[model samples]
Target: MTRILIVGGGYVGMNVALRLQRRLRHHAEITILDADSYMTYQPFLPEAAAGNLEPRHLVVPLRQVLHRCRMLNGWVVGVDSERRTVRFRPHQGEGYDLPYDLLVYAPGSVSRLLPVPGLAECGIGFKTVEEAIHLRNHVLAQLDLASSTRDEAIRRRALTFVFVGAGFAGVEALAELEDMAKDACRYFPAVDAADMRWILVEATGRILPEVGPEMGAWTLEQLRRRGIDVRLDTRVRSAENGRVVLDDGDEFDTDTLVWTAGVRPHPLVRATDLPRDDKDRVKVTPHLTVVGRPEVFAAGDSAAVPDLTRPGELCAPNAQHAVRQARTIADNIVARLRGRPLREYRHAYAGSVASLGLHKGVAQVYGVKLRGPLAWLTHRSYHLTRIPTVNRKVRVLVDWTLALFFPRDIVSLGALAEPRKEFEFAAGAPDGAKTGTQDGTETTVPRPAGARF
Candidate 1:
């Protein structure tokens, strides 16, 4: 049996595994290597952050979905395509080499962080389920702190939320969270909706470039109508010590800073002995095969796939392309194994849908525009079909159904991030002190000084 090694169990990786398992079955041995055991449906992240849907429901367990394929929880540190060996490093173990007859490189993209000051320390990225949940807890915690604090400066800072980047992630995340925060204020007597400051800073002149300028402008108008300070054609010069300094000579203190600035190809791509384009993405033909390497295939955000619909353009690194590319990848891989003619991936760009809080959204599909409740419903209905697994789909639908009756869950479980802190202090174990395990192994786990949120 042929050993097929797949890197990054994300949208492309997980889907490819699922398709291959059904197609190739016992004919080939498939192994997926990923940092996380679950695949996150990123479209639902904003809703998850807003407590509209449970974060746990947004992720599909790789092991559960890809039962036939072997699952390895690790990061691909390096890949030697010439040797057909991949170097993988687990969360708590040493590195190892894995040999494979065929390679599927779909490690996905990481947050494309700029060299802005204090960003690494202060800003949070909205990508994974963990980040989404953390952001929700953190945002709610900020509201809690602001309501309780008597200091005007601290209260002001805590209530002020600043989101950088006006892409789908940034805009939707801010919109949903803002709506949740505003609704949450009804319970806090000390805080009002007007007291809190919500600001959106975009480097580009437009927002939601996926939905076109008209919809983007309309979104801008809608956001501005909601009293959100939408600053266009501006950049974040610095975010030092919770103080945000913008290029347009404006500065403000904010306890919350979300950086959804966009993404770059995962560093693992650069570490591979693969043909990379100028953008550092694996150069691939329309068949999803890596350039000059028949045994190696790449797709999703990591592959610079040529756009057949448009001449001289690469497919945009988005979920729309990634999910469809997955189908072609699986088909091509099976064809390669069976000595059959492989099919080329050719799909025209489908328009985008963006939810702006409950009962409000904007969508552009096949040049047909939709807004308000219709668009919001479209956004939910579209993602509902895409998130994977009937179990997850039903659960998410139930969540939305429940939301129509009950209020949104605004409780902050920030302490969950540092569950051991209180216990360690109670046990009289000093911060960074070594603790003995059941097998008499000593490990030093550093106790957090306080809640970072």
Candidate 2:
């Protein structure tokens, strides 16, 4: 029996695995090994962070969808291309090897981080469900802290939020979360909406570069109208000591720093013996097969598959290409298994859509530029059609419907992210002795002046 092993259960891995299960007709023994057991629908992450969508609904269980294929919850550490084996560490045990007659390498990208000061300790990426939840909790907690504080400076710092990138993730996240925070203001009498500040700092001259210059300008105008401070052609030099310094020489103290700069292919891709492109993506043929390796194939963000539609350009790392490429890859695998001819992958760039809060959005679909409520509606409709599974589609739609009638849920569950922090601090404190000046006042750790309330 032919054995097929797929490494990574992301958009590409899950989609290809499903397509293979359908086309292979039980002739192949397919197994998918992923670091996480769930497949995250990444596009919904911004909404998840804003509480517009539930974190649970943002991911689909692999076991539920890939019913026919064996799902191994583990990390793929190494690939021995010479022996046609992959080295993986399971969740509960030591590393093991899995041999495959044919392999599909689709380990997706990770947050592309830079060596900026204080970023590692202070910043949060908006990639996974965990990160989204953390961001939502942190944002809400900031508001809570600010409302409870009497210190004007501390309140000001706590209410200030900064986003480093202006790409799809950063822009959408800022818009949605700002909208949520604005609606949540009704619960806090002390904290006014005008007191809160949302800042977007982009090194590039434009945001949503994927949507063309006109739409990008329109988005900037919309955000500005909402009082969002967008700093284009500006770079963040450092964010150390709770002080954010920009290239333009502006400095401010802020607590929330969101890093959605960009993404890079998984580091495991570098371990593979296969040829790679300049961007560290595996170099693949037009048919999505790795160069000089007939048995191994790759696609999606991790693979640099030649874009036949544009002779000089490689396919952009987006769901539009990932989904289309997965189909072609599955078909090619099926053809190879059955001794038939394989087809090449080719697709033109469809326009993009961006949601700028509730009834405001920008879209350039099929060369038609739309803005305001119509664009927002189109954005929702497009994603609703693309999100996998009837169960997910219905649930997401229900969430949207509820959002119309009910106020946004701005409750902070920040402790959930670091549940044991307080316990650890308590455990380390001096033996039941209140360490403070003797004035019958309980000793409290003095937070940094710039730290959030």
Best-fitting candidate, measured by TM-score? 1
Model 2, backbone clash pairs (residues 3+ apart or across chains), number: 0
Top lDDT prediction, candidate number:
1
| Model 2: lDDT of residue 415 | 71
Candidate 2 residue 341 Cα shift, in angstroms, is: 0.9
Query: Lowest-scoring 10 consecutive residues by lDDT in candidate 2?
Result: 444-453
Off by over 4 Å in 2: 420-453
**Candidate 2, residue 150: CA error in Å?**
1.6
List, residue by residue over 173-290, the lDDT tens digit for candidate 2: 9999999888888898988899999999999889999899989998999899999999999988888967889999999998999999999999989877888878899989998999
Residue pairs clashing in model 1 are: none
lDDT (tens digit, per residue) of candidate 1 on 397-430? 9999999999998889998988888766656764
